[model samples]
Target: MSAPSTPPAADAARRPARGRPPRLDQARTVEAALVLLDESGLDALTMRRLADAVGVQAGALYRHFATKGDLLTAMAERMLADCSTPPPDPDWSGRLTALARRLRTALLAHRDGARVYAGTHSTGAGTLGFAETLIGVLGEAGFGPQEAARTALTVVHYTVGHTLEEQAALQPGDQGPADPERLREAVADAGLPHLTAALPVLTGTDFTAQFEFGLGLLLRGLRGLRRDGSGPGA
Candidate 1:
């Protein structure tokens, strides 16, 4: 009893719809958000924009990120993911120097990367692991837990603050503070003797040298404190 076979076109028409593609997961969403950040800066990285970039509705993002802050924290975590381990150095100062430089490099990689990391407090694996390594280095160098923790925080703050200024001054189309000649002229006009004296080095575009100089100052202070046996728990 072979009934007439249904028409091929009719059979195809009866198939259920495949529907839209699956929504992006949290990691992919963060990745896309980072791309958007690099392209348009943080102000343009709205959730709606990110959703569009991911080919999903804005509400779909809520499934992964509770809020924009949450997404930002995730992005911050991603930025530090590669910095979990400290560089190999014989001494704590050297290790800290390398770690600080690595962090600056990471923050300078994307547009407003330091801004992305500044406010968010991410307890993610990357952030925590980096902190653990820094603290561990300090501890191994004869610093007690309190001193190690405080020293680690001081290093992080200095690195982030320096990178923030560096990124802002170097941003494209930003001619305000980055103009060495203009700054020098202003200092001279203001009759600021000390500033004028230091203008050459201060206005130089040698951020690496400036950063190293500041780091050396901090390490020297720490060493002095250790030597004086005045540091906490010493």
Candidate 2:
């Protein structure tokens, strides 16, 4: 007979420990990417940098995302996740204004956030849900599907464009005029008659006030469209 076999427990103990690392998924990768993104802008968010931040090898990132573009899209999806919440306002214009404010807040939360948001297609639940809400509001306001979609997109695009300029100006080394007198003098020296006349209000930039003012203008224009029979079902 062969020598007595080792006991089952002893045999199990003799096997080598599994050395593989824990697997990471898309959400975890996006979480790590966002942290890195908030500290450093989009350009610094390379796969190697993200992998290191997440405690994985660079190649492992490809398992969750095929390319950097795919990763950026995921980032954008997370950005809009908070926008999926239901609006508190009953009026269509109020709902649109609230939505615009929420989107602006989201874009301003991260470094270079607008750049990350720009040109990205997010098929994520949050993005779709927010779109559905906006369209629904427009529907309640007597807009057809096409006009409703256009209205929603117009608001979103305006928010994005405004926030892009806001974020860019906030970046390092791009501060606007600190001396009001100098700015006024420069404007006067330029001999821009109309611009000079408007310098008092134009030179002092209050982004919040300016955004709301412009939003009101757009909403007024939309209301005019509906009143004039230029809107859907007109």
Local accuracy of candidate 2 as per-residue lDDT tens digits, 119-178: 988888988988998888888889999999998899889988888877776777765423
TM-score (C-alpha) between model 1 and the true structure: 0.88
Instruction: Per model, state how many residue pairs clash.
Output: 0, 0
Candidate 1 error regions (>4 Å): 1-19
Steric clash pairs (candidate 1): none
Error of 1 at 102 (Å): 1.4
Model 2 per-residue lDDT at 35:
78
What TM-score would every model get versus the actual structure?
0.88, 0.85
Deviation in Å, model 1, residue 27 alpha carbon: 0.6
User: How many clashes does the backbone of model 1 have?
Assistant: 0
